[model samples]
Target chain A: MDTAQVFGALNIIGLFVFAVSGALTALRNDMDIFGVAMIAFVTGVGGGTIRDVLLGSFPVWWIAAPSAVFICLAGAVAATLAQPLIASRLKTLIWADAMGLSVFAVLGAQAALAAEAPAVIAIFMGAVTATFGGVVRDVLLNEPPLILKQDIYATAALIGAGVYVGLMALGLGISPSAVVAALVTFAIRAVAIIFNIPSPKFARPRKTEL
Target chain B: MDTAQVFGALNIIGLFVFAVSGALTALRNDMDIFGVAMIAFVTGVGGGTIRDVLLGSFPVWWIAAPSAVFICLAGAVAATLAQPLIASRLKTLIWADAMGLSVFAVLGAQAALAAEAPAVIAIFMGAVTATFGGVVRDVLLNEPPLILKQDIYATAALIGAGVYVGLMALGLGISPSAVVAALVTFAIRAVAIIFNIPSPKFARPRKTEL
Candidate 1:
């Protein structure tokens, strides 16, 4: 497939995975079905939409295609319906979420470039598009953003987008470049999760320090 | 004053008001001092900064000037120290917030216009900038966004921005148009609050509905 086709397919997959991530978080947070769906939609698409607007691509993704909305709704409903059984498998969901995050980082930069964004902007947009929605979701749920807390989330996106843009600048064909970028990101995040890579530790405060 | 100057003044007043509004909300929620300060800072300036970045203004407000951060911190400290006494006088804080919201709408539109945004985009930015941060604060605290539930919040911003843009398009001076817009918005909101204006009632479920 060509670059456009590769990016499009990956983007859809990222959206679905992103929705699943949001639904999982919502489930853990004890949100209702509607609440889960709303969180899912926002988590899956909010960052990309923000990036697009910043880049002046209006009508936004969900507005441009109702299918994304429909799919996100279905995912949330499925999560709610499966909660009784699925809660036992949160480990699996986290890995899936990491994969989703990686895909989004790669796809985001590609989309920005296709939309004619500058290279540095494309990389930043990629990271923001991949990760900030989860931050929003976490903040709304009263959790510190995923970026601030745990394993290599925003950094993974940043590196992945940077690599993709760098490769493109080096005149590599877009499809191979995208595949390498997505795979590298996915490997990094998936290995981190699967092998239980520890996040950088915050300094421990003594009880009397405060 | 030019459009930029009008927005600059409104921004200063808005900084104080929004900080107070956020700190007061945090106080009512019984957050600790640090939590209160954080909420105050984010709610005071977060929305407009987000709007500005999405509109391609870099460094955002807090990053551009450290003073805005100090103002929010001071507001938080003031609210924290005074909450025991101020709790009984909640309406005062509410009125102050309403005033801030009105001015934020005017300033939001003016900022967008100064950035040379299209009129329609400016109006949208006005609504988003005035209403989004509070919405973020409410959602983070797990409350329904005020615009989704109560008085005419986003609607008021839209109306004011529309009026301002209309006047300015007719070659009216910026400050005069902005002042008129802000005054009209503040009056509408103040009157509505005094009269206890509400959104249209949701259809109540009958005895058999459940």
Candidate 2:
């Protein structure tokens, strides 16, 4: 497979996990079925959609394919239907979300490169496409976005993108470059979670000189 | 002014409006003082920040100057201090918002042109920059965005950008072209509000046969 195809596969896999994570979040928040579906849809496509739309991508990347929508639906439905059984065992969802965040970050940077965007732009796109979906999800749930919280979500994605840039600068092949980036992101998120890296709780402003 | 200076002026003016509008939104939503400031900051810069960051225009446009941050702070402070007086004139907020929207749309497009972007991208950028801030505000408020609401807000902005493009195609000078576009946008938005023009709303999905 070409490098693009490899990244495409990773993107699809990431979409699935993001969608599932969104659905499970909705269910936990006690939203209705439509809300669950909406959250899933938004989270799955949110990052890439923002990237493409701003890049002036015609027809939008996801609109060109039924596969994206279909997978999101399947994941949402599965999460919604299986919430009762799976809520008891939360480890799977957490792991899936972490993996998806990594994969999405890698694929996002690759897509930016493929679009012939500048390196700085590619790295920013990677982080935005990786983390903004979860931000939307959390904001919609009335929680502080994961980024604003103490979680290393956006930070992990950014560091991964930096690695990707470094590898490319070294004249490494795209295949190895992408894989290395994804692995770096995955490791950051996993290690952070395992070590109980906690997000800062949303707080009111304290007394200060203004 | 030089071409770049003109673009610079439009950007700062647009940011001013956006910041003020965001503060007003927070006030209307009954947010805390800090919450209001945060909302104002985000709403004022959110859309353009998204546009520039994704486009790799770092350290994003506002980071170049302390002015954008100052404006946001100023707006928030004014709004907070003027809450009683502002509250008494809640009826005027819509007009203020509409005016801000129109100015921002034209400014966004003009900036894109100055940057030598394609006509289509410039047009989209106008709408994106004007609308996305409100979208973030509404989403945070758990309301469907104004864009998806029954109004001609986006349509007005879109037409204004087209007008700007048309003027340029007709070999009009940049100053005249910009003036015409801004006038057109303001007129469209004003007419919509005065005449109560409404866009169609999204309906719930209809049931289908299995």
Candidate 3:
């Protein structure tokens, strides 16, 4: 398959996984079926929507291609039905989410390039596209945003996007570049997950006595 | 002043108020200055950005008009410095917020119309413009979205947007239509704030014994 085909297939998979994660979060929060679907749609598509908006891509990707919407809805329903099994395998879920993030980061950069965005903006778009959906989900669930909580998540996305953009600039084939980028992201995130690597935290200021 | 001039002046005030609200929320959450500025910018411009993106307007309004950005940043700084006084004057804050909502709804609809969006789409855009900023603010602050909660806030926006659209369809001049619509929104929200009106909520479903 060509780069476009490969990216298309991986993007669909990423969307499904992200949707499932969103549904799972919604279910954990005791949301009803509609809420589950809403969260799933938001989590699966929110990042891309933000990226597209910033790039001035109108109608948004999902609206132009309803297949993504269908996939997300299906994934949410499947997740709702299999919540017990999925929730029990926390490690498996995290791995799947990492894979989704990796794929999304590469795809986001490609989309930005297509939009003729600058390299920095493209990288930023990639990171936002990869992770902002989860941020939206966490926000709706009234949880601290995982990105801001220092899981090394956004950093992973930034590195992945940077790698992809840099390789493309060097005249590397898109497919190979994307593959390398995705692998780098997934590997870094997996290592972080396994090692429980804590991101650096700021020291809290001491309270002064009046 | 013409309708455009009036809208321009009110829009700046709306942006400032919205930015102040966002900055105050960030301050309460103990975020740093950057976070305060980020939140303020998002809350001030997020709604219009969403609307413009959906309509396929390029570069976004804030990017095209740096004045908005400057206003929001200044508002955030001012809010940060005046936190104590602003926080103490809760009633005044609410009144300002109501005014912002009123102006945003009308302006949002006008923007949609300028983009040649269909009437229904314009109305929806208006509501999104009026309320999505607060949604962004609440989400960032890890609070349940106020629009989805009580107080009839979204309802007020919808009514105002609808009234404006309906008036325009009836061949009412833009300025008069906007004035009537803004008044309607402000009146409804003000009454709700004064009377402590509670939006109807659905009763929780009984848990079935498995």
Best model number under TM-score: 3
Model 2, residue pairs in steric clash: A150-A200
Tens-place lDDT digits, model 3, residues B1-210: 798887888689889988887776665555545456666877888888888777778867665466776799898888766754543534544665677788899889989988888998888899999998888788866856757654878889888999999999999999899889989999999889889898777985778933
Runs in model 1 lying further than 4 Å from the true structure: A1-45, A50-109, A112-210, B1-5, B87-90, B200-210
**Local lDDT at B172 for model 1:** 88
Chain B TM-score of candidate 1 stands at 0.87
Candidate 3 per-residue lDDT, tens place, A105-130, comes to 99999998887777866776788789
Ranking by lDDT: 3, 1, 2
Between candidates 1 and 2, the DockQ winner: 2
Per-model lDDT: 0.74, 0.72, 0.80
- Candidate 2 per-residue lDDT, tens place, B1-210, comes to 765676567666666666676776665544544445556766777777666754556445653354666777786776556655543423344565666677677767766776788999988888877777777766655555767753788888888888988898899987777778877888988888788876656875768832
Query: lDDT by residue for model 2 over A4-83, one digit each (tens)?
Result: 78777888888888899888888778899889888988888888876665555656787778789888888899887777
| Predicted model with the maximum DockQ | 3
- For model 3 chain B, give the 10-residue run with minimal summed lDDT: B84-93
DockQ of each two-chain model = 0.06, 0.08, 0.13
